[model samples]
Target: MKRIFLIAALICSSIIVLQSCSPKTTSGAPAVKRSGVTGNWVLNNITFDGIPDIAVKSFLGESSYKCFIGSTWSLTNSGNGSYSLPSSATCAAKTQTIFWSVNAADGTFQFKKLYQGDKAKNVTEGYRLMLAAADDVNMTIKSPIEYGNKTAYIIMNFSKAAK
Candidate 1:
């Protein structure tokens, strides 16, 4: 079982998940969205496709995906980052440390939970989200879940928040 939100210090660079989004720049060079992954981000909303809202009990093994709305995420260049869950009427306030990275060519974003004294290399189980889009101010990641012989997606929408 794994928790969520681990990337390192915000040094100004991040993941580039743009396999099909490799638009050529003015100079005809491939544009990478690496810079879009770093910095402070807020999970503004979550949308589900082909899955009932009541079907899921938790997201990332932490809490209900509904509870994740408004969560703040920080992904650093060093592969260390954290997400803060603000206390709500139904959700408790929590901050989780994580180690995260992306397979840019494949448009995959993955992260592992970091418990005290736990090494990332030793933890094999992690959560993966498909990067639908990641620009300077917004990012969309999709978590695919298998349900009743069908694949459903949990779409997370995030917007950048300046430090």
Candidate 2:
């Protein structure tokens, strides 16, 4: 009985590990191409879904969600990028470096902020946002959060910056 229990435990753990390590998207969606995501994008607008705007105090673990408006994000095919925030009364202006990737099948857009001398692989924590849309002209992503014991989303709107 002891040996049988141990084997069962091992099997369960192994399955969990394998699934966690899999390269698939968490939503099990088919891989989407990344061409639309690489370019200069302006965070043109932001909206709250199924929740009041006052419910969200900050975004991307940074300043208030409103501060990100008009921010310019430049993503390259090499997975390197940065977003420059415009000056706001509640948020200071700054440019932050990041390494980002989009899951081919799942539309899971993830990025990790990189500090000086920091390696992307060494950064274990990052932010994940759903890639709602992306193309040569526009892109949209949603940041999901828990609110009132229910799921809420912060919708982000982006437009390609002019050349």
Candidate 3:
């Protein structure tokens, strides 16, 4: 009888521990805001097969008329396996929200930009966000969109501020 009670107690304790260890899911609402991308991000490198590298560099660097480093943006977790940018509208004529959904196991982030227009909008405007970290270096950026489409993608990468 004593052994049976001990085993039951152990089982209950194990169940509690497992439940506590699980990660809680967000309910498609904005949860935590990403604070890492609030500042400037400079372009270090860009590559796109078939297309001219200059085009990628220009978009990533925002060199034509806009500066990616100077553009003000914000990041917020959508709680539904994605994140929203600028919970408020700040860009000119760009009343849209951008999202970044990354696989927690793979680190490959999908970049999406959703517009507020009556039209269905476009996904070609979406890109990917990648991150790499090592003992000596850490990098983050919006990667290029390879698909041919009418929308343009602005990809940029940045390193963390030096200590």
Instruction: Give the winner by lDDT.
Output: 2
TM-score of 1: 0.78
* Local accuracy of candidate 2 as per-residue lDDT tens digits, 1-163: 9999999999999999999898963555435577769989999999988889997877887858888999999999999999999998888999999999998766889999999999999999999989987878888898889998989999999999997
Candidate 2 Cα outliers beyond 4 Å, as residue runs: 1-31
Q: CA shift at 102, candidate 3, in angstroms?
A: 1.8
Q: Which residue pairs show collisions in model 2?
A: 30-105, 31-104, 31-105, 32-104
Query: Where's the lowest-lDDT run of ten residues in candidate 2?
Result: 24-33
Per-residue lDDT of model 3, residues 45-143, tens digit only: 333444554555344222332334333333345412222122223223222355555454444455565555522234565555553321123334435
lDDT values, one for every candidate: 0.83, 0.89, 0.43
Worst 10 residues of 1 by lDDT: 1-10
Alpha-carbon TM-score of each model against the true structure: 0.78, 0.80, 0.37
> Taking the tens digit of each residue's C-alpha lDDT, what string does model 1 give over 28-90?
222335566988999999999999889988999776887789999999987899899989988
lDDT of 2 at 73: 97
Clashes of each: 11, 4, 0
Pick by TM-score: 1 or 3, better one: 1
